[model samples]
Target: MAAGQHFFGPWDYVVLVIVLLISASIGVYYRFTGGKQKTMQEYLLADKNMSIIPVAFSLMASFMSAITLLGVSSENYTFGIQFIVINISYGIFTPVAAYLYLPVFFKLQATSAYEYLERRFGKASRLAASLSYTLQMTLYMGVVLYAPALALEALTGISKVAAILSVGLVCTFYSTIGGMKAVLITDVFQSLLMFAAVFSVIIYAVIDKGSFDEIWNIAERGNRTDLLNFNPDPTERHSWFSLIIGGGITFLSLYAVNQTQVQRYLTVKDLKRAQTALWLNWPILTCLSLSTSFSGLAIYSKYAACDPVKAKVINSPDQLMPLYVVDTMGDIPGLSGLFVAGIFSASLSTVSAAVNSLAAVTIEDYYKPLYKSIFGKSLSEKTIAIQSKLIALLFGLLCLAVAFLAQFLGGVLQASLTIFGVVGGPLLALFTLGMFTTTANEKGSLFGLLCGISFALWMAFGNPKPPLPALPVTTEGCSSVFTNVTVVAEPQLTRATTQQQEYFWLYKVSYLYNGVFGLLSTYIIGYVASLVINKIKGVSTQNLDPHLFITPIARRLERTMDIPLNTKELSDSQEELNGKYEVNGKY
Candidate 1:
């Protein structure tokens, strides 16, 4: 902590302020530019004509929030680099999102992802899924907004309230005023800062340790460099099986079908560009993920001899990276500021995405439908456009309030990610059931979603689960400068307690597998329930849109199942064919 203990310097403050001003300026720039964001389409989907690069970056930035920057590093620092294996899952699941799920949403051209559910199953299913997504993003954004604030508090002596407000309000301003176009463009900028922030830690650590290999060697000696584990046990944390299979499903949940990303995909002019953007996201996301994981080991190398938590230097692992930056790099003007700005950018990119996507969902799923049902007609697009901004503002505020409560939710990485798994798995399952299976009915999908969420929540929070073990650390190397400070011995879970746990088996399963449990439970239960419901009610499963299902499955179903393709429902015009009917011809 002696390297540079003065916190943010004048240059650092300038860098941080400049970043915020620029982010806000982008929104104001787009507010008065082309189309002026007055139409719902322009406001939410960037008029459906955005470029591939920005859209690609936006897709990556949407979920790769401050949580990833802080949590992943802490995860690596405390646990090990085995978590990096999740990056491979991102690459493996990219096509599943691009080919299997993206095409359905792209062809449908729905503003909200859940709208496809209405077309495929029924309105009830659409509403159910939309509600689930709203809850998921709300909880996730709370953690996103809170992470940087926590860091700023730890590093700069700023109150968490001030830190949260400074970042959250700026994000809300740009997101509400600039709309999706602003979000996409700002995401590209913010994503670079995110990279710069992570690289600062790695570069500093490498310089301090004298080489990158030395960092890895130190991590290896500390038992933090193991990247391959073939254990089949789901309860064994960080196994290859859990990181791949479980992480892959989590990737598909976010990229393939999440409204935040699917909306970004639709910003492009054609499906080809959108898919290209999605494919490009894989590398960008993996690059950041792998870099962040290494940054953890980088920070670990700094404190390998004297553990921070054991020495009472920091209260939590989430504070490690920020503490490392201020302790080691703060003497250099604007360096710590650049890192803080990067952290802020991560939170801004993610929160803005959530704000926009949640607004889209609110309008398309709840507001419009409820209005139509009550007023017996739809509102004008101009009115809806105005309301959309207001909705975005309100959601932004809601997330800000939730950020205050996120401290109670445990570690940012696991808590934010668990929110995805608990909600994402079933939502992915619901969509897959409709798109992949011909027999899935609306009632059955809803039933399975409810059941899946209930079980996943129970698994996540039902019992007093055993604490996860971390690599051993020693405070013996701590100097006499703090001899008065008592060093508490890190707790040990002996074999007696480790071997006989009273917690439920499901509760003991790795958090990585929470989504898998939800996905499997929902898919299996929904499929079986659909069969029973369809059988009892004699529900007709014919005259369905072939384009509504996944391309390969729809083609197979049409070839063998004798179900009508419903081509006449779509017009004979080439624009309609290309826009909506995918199975008829490729995009």
Candidate 2:
């Protein structure tokens, strides 16, 4: 309970060191083996030869980092378990990602996802979307890098600077040297530790209390078990409607179109394998999400009467899990270290993914174009291979610097999701406009993306907003347990009673709806603007590329071409359609 007192024992440090060493060694192994990352494809996309299982695990680990581990548990402890309903939206949208959007990227097979935007719209559209993506990932990874620092500072009694530096340096080292191959394999190994960490809390809670049923019952009595809310109001925080509809949009925005996951999907052999990996990721993701949510209840059952935050044992709700581990399980030696290692692994997986993907975007989307514009030629493969590693290293350090600013952001879960929604929604709308409809053009889509981001940012942080009220907590039991420490009196919960009509209506809406607002704003405005521009300019749509659209739309458009086809011509077309469409004169 004193400052500078180390929570980890000797064995704890040993376990933690071994975990970090093993992670770094995986990168080393991949760097020295086969192809040796001599080409850009091998370095960035894993040479398109990865197995399905590792890719699936990597996909889950990349986004569901320590942010989920720390934030979701705190979310359930403070608000309730209603956040678990978002998993249902994941299942509902997995097919959309697998069948619809996955095919477009798979068929194109470009290193950067923004390259699809370039071919579909134009150079201007691609630049706009890619820069938005770069900003989004940088902000999200900054929050991710800050997560482990909280764990370290809480358990080890050290400054956050040490934690952030250790994680950033090691993650950047392995991901930079090992390339995509190392990232995927390390993610698989780290995914196991993530599961171990969450399970440790549940197992300890059962031992500390009597049984799982008692934990659930205690949580129910504490008013944290309410799950069913069908409210249709968009302003409601965690209702079935918000979780299902709004959460589904967020899911599509990330899993369907975001570059981090899309790059993972591209590492596999072909479209079928990629789709299989996408389907497999849902159950793995859902399992971790449900366990993490329950772990919150597991911690809450112990502090139901004597809240740690109320007792001033922890500074914030995010510190509750680490403090609980040190209080109840510190004597178990390696258990506490394993939990911290899991949190570290979560941050490593996410930050590494962002680092690699950001580098890829920079090379293909930004660097290549600038090089061509100034020099009138493409760079050699050797230069690309060398520069990709440097770009990855630079971006990792940039994200590390950004982590210092994450203290200004509030909760880890909301901050990460808010980033996804604010930027990801408009990007998803841009891709959807290109693939699903035939009317959207370059100028309109660029305008729509910029406006959508502006609107979402305003909704998320435009005005000073009230804090979300937590369930009732008390220090009645803490008074008997800690005689020397001062337990703060249970203050009145007044924020919930404040007049809702006082704040701006957009600010009053739930953070979950930010993506939905962005998607609607972009798609509706982009489509209408495109129609207006086409009418005024008298532009014709007769020569658009069929491959730019999805399969059904592309096939229908092929049938509507100007030249009439005989039976033999139709037969030839059927055979070509059965295989793949030509893009830029080659598949």
Candidate 3:
């Protein structure tokens, strides 16, 4: 690897430091001024008075970060235009979350969405989900820090280990001190920079090549023909069926039930704003995914034929995006700075969000319950926040520690993503079954979640090299990176491919599929266990009230289902509902 003198220019460092100081300054001001909000409602939901536009965009921006920026783009670089199809998941599944889970969550108006699992199924179900979510989120938060750190590590000579502390510390400061208001508001700025970084890469890519069409032709040559094959083959990796069904379930679980996302929905001033935010998130994410993918395409056009891997500096496709920036645009004073701005932008917003949300969950779900159990139901927000911040610090340190786990392994983006999905699969099912089906009682929910998680570990990461089938890649005219470059896996391109191959069977299990598997098992096992537990524990599925689970649209469709909608009795939950809500109406 060729190494050179590396430094961020004075102007660039100034911009970076100024960004950090500005965020910290706002944190200090808000800590005193608008920071009077110390109640659980204030900390977790922002007093539920946030304007719709910023709230919705915050949700979009928070959800869309370096993870998606690097993730989908890397997928595209490695997989081709095939990765573009994730938009289908974001577009359809997000609104599905709005309709399916939002109705119950809003109706219950619980601070933590997992609270419903306890109320509806039982405490065991909630514990199962909460513990799993904490695990999922901790690892996820680590990646949030870890991913952008990869970008900075490649850019600056700083070790990946040190980059994490720098990123984690600043984010922890804002998130711990500023709370959700700080997180959502600052996220707006981060989102803007996030787009700037992506679009800047695009602009630089276009400037170097002249026109989009010219770049497309160059990129098309490096494309894999099989990448675009969208057959519903059971064994194919990332097939259309897997992308839609598997991706849909994962999105549904993650967006609908996860406290991190639910916490964002609470920031909306009213349900109306929540609804608006929910509706807006789909297309915004869809567009963001496409933009990142194009950024990868840009990287491919410049280096795919040369097969930069052949050059040895960038052995993996994931590194190609960052390397392209350094090689092509780094000479400009802040171009490297701009990319880092984008990187930190993406990392900082999400990391702060994680810290705040984790604090919320710890206080409400875990700490509060323990407090009540140990003493009584009366714990002040001040006490909870202090405990929560301490948890946040510990959580931050744990995430920082986990970030190093990936460094030992080679830079493989898909492996990281799939590892997350495999573990998260079971948790997704617990929430899905709790909200979707009345038959899944507490016992069933717990059993199903455990079963689903156990199975996922066995399937996705159980074996070394994973006996799963490989997707095809087009490399007919591909030059060996130095001829010493090892050929590991075949590639695939989208439709209009120049080559073809049979789909592999074992690949029926993509990471996304884990969500479906978990959701299904939770339902199936939940019902069976309900009977056994009902006998032993004297439980009652008989009282599984349809009213608790129905949606606004379901009210309109109730006539056909024989479930009567009483407008008068809706008053019981009305006081909980704000006049500003986003629902169609509770029947």
Candidate 4:
């Protein structure tokens, strides 16, 4: 585990080069063979004709970044299988997204998910949601880029900055040129690569570590297999309630409101296919989580005697998977390269999806409207398509710049969930209020969104004090026969802090609950404010647009209040409403 001790050899370099070159070549292929991306729809949505399988795989690729691959294993190694609660959360929420959220966007034929905000509320609401999403993705992309770069730097002795730039440039190239089509195509390949790379490690670990019983014995004895913790404490990081409820809210924010995911849903040609694609993601993601979690146990079994952290072989838990791969697979030539390539694949897929979605939102939500207002004319399809490419390039560079900042952040899993809670939570709340209720008005939503964001930020970053670090564990169970050399332990220093261990009440809330708090805060505030405004202004709820609410909500209101819910009339009215906004270039 010394510096450059298990660096990639020549064949490994060949494998890595092949993976990068194939990704770039996909971009070239789409640029030349797919014809010109003359319209925003073509560039951003792949003309909405994408098939179910590729889109499903692309969703998997986007969802399972290097952080999931590396961080999940690290988590299992450190905390046991309780992290599987996240997958359970996904299982519960993906259907909610498909049934409740997907139809609204699909029915509107909206280019941007935030566009529905404009149609339902006003331009200000749309801008608020879109800006929040753009910021979230931009920040998350940095962590996505940084994770693989850090891993590769350890595995192949490549400079971390170089690894980040290589991924950034390649993803940007294909994504800018080929747009969503190339991104999805490459994602399919990357997903397969990820499966291969992970399974190879698992297969090798099984062979090296003996039968499943032995590995399970080692892991169970080390307290790595505990799956269910029903602790009800809100402050506890991983509990059944936190993981189920908090994790459900977190996943809902991603699958329902996040632009990266919505963009994938919009790529398909029909609602049925889109729903099918979403269903496909569950099993794929579940398998991946189980595989990596098992890999963690295998890693624990392999290193049962000599704890790398205690031995000073690695600085953090995130580095454990890479260390294990290098130690176990170093003699297998191109295997290390494939593993690095797999990490890069995960990073590239996630970043490319972010870049493409960011560009789409920039044009559809911001640029197109501004250009029309100032110039008093719409830009041609060709010009808009070109602008989209430039926007992708710009955002890709921005991601690289911010990636340098991620090195100072905490573990990848916690950092990413915190970002989701801080940004995605408020965004999800705004959309939920708009889509589920007819009473929420523009002024109310705007106020609620601002307040939600401020509160979430306080919860995420208001604490100035760091928690005490846990004590390191010994590797006494690891067989002495594996290592005969005497290893010296370095003295560890502890810091005693007399500063009062006080924190703002909000700061003590687990990051897992940020989304639920933000969602409820925004909706309740917005709904109440709208009721007051309606009472003062004497506005009639009966006269409001029914399409502003979800189908079930609208139907329930019709039953309860005897309000006539005319489906055809509502469809026509919504079409006309969006048409009016589109004509003004404010859609």
lDDT against the true structure, per candidate, is: 0.84, 0.85, 0.66, 0.78
Which wins on TM-score, candidate 1 or candidate 4? 1
**For candidate 1, which ten residues in a row score worst on lDDT?**
578-587
CA RMSD, predictions in order: 3.9, 3.9, 6.4, 3.4
**lDDT string, candidate 2, 287-370, tens digits:** 999999999999998788788777777677887788778877888889888889999977887888888999999999999989
Q: What TM-score against the true fold does each predicted structure earn?
A: 0.93, 0.94, 0.86, 0.92
TM-score ranking from best candidate downward: 2, 1, 4, 3
Candidate 3 residue lDDT tens string, 1-587: 13233446776677777776765665566566664557767766777777766666677776557777666666666666676676687777777778677766766677777887776666666776777777877777777777777777667757777888888776666676776776677777777777887887789879988988877876677553234567776455677778777777667766777788888887765455677788887777777778888887787666665555544455355556666677676677867776777778667777777777777777777888888999977687788767777787777777777777755433344544555566556776676666565456665668877887777666655434333332233333345422334445546766867555443333335666665666666567766776666567764444343445646434544444443445344446454333322221111
The superposed Cα distance between candidate 2 and the true structure at residue 404, in angstroms, equals 1.3
Whichever of 1 and 3 has more TM-score, that candidate is 1
TM-score of decoy 1: 0.93
Model 2 misplaced regions, further than 4 Å: 1-6, 479-484, 490-501, 561-587
In model 1, what lDDT does residue 246 have?
88
| TM-score between model 2 and native | 0.94
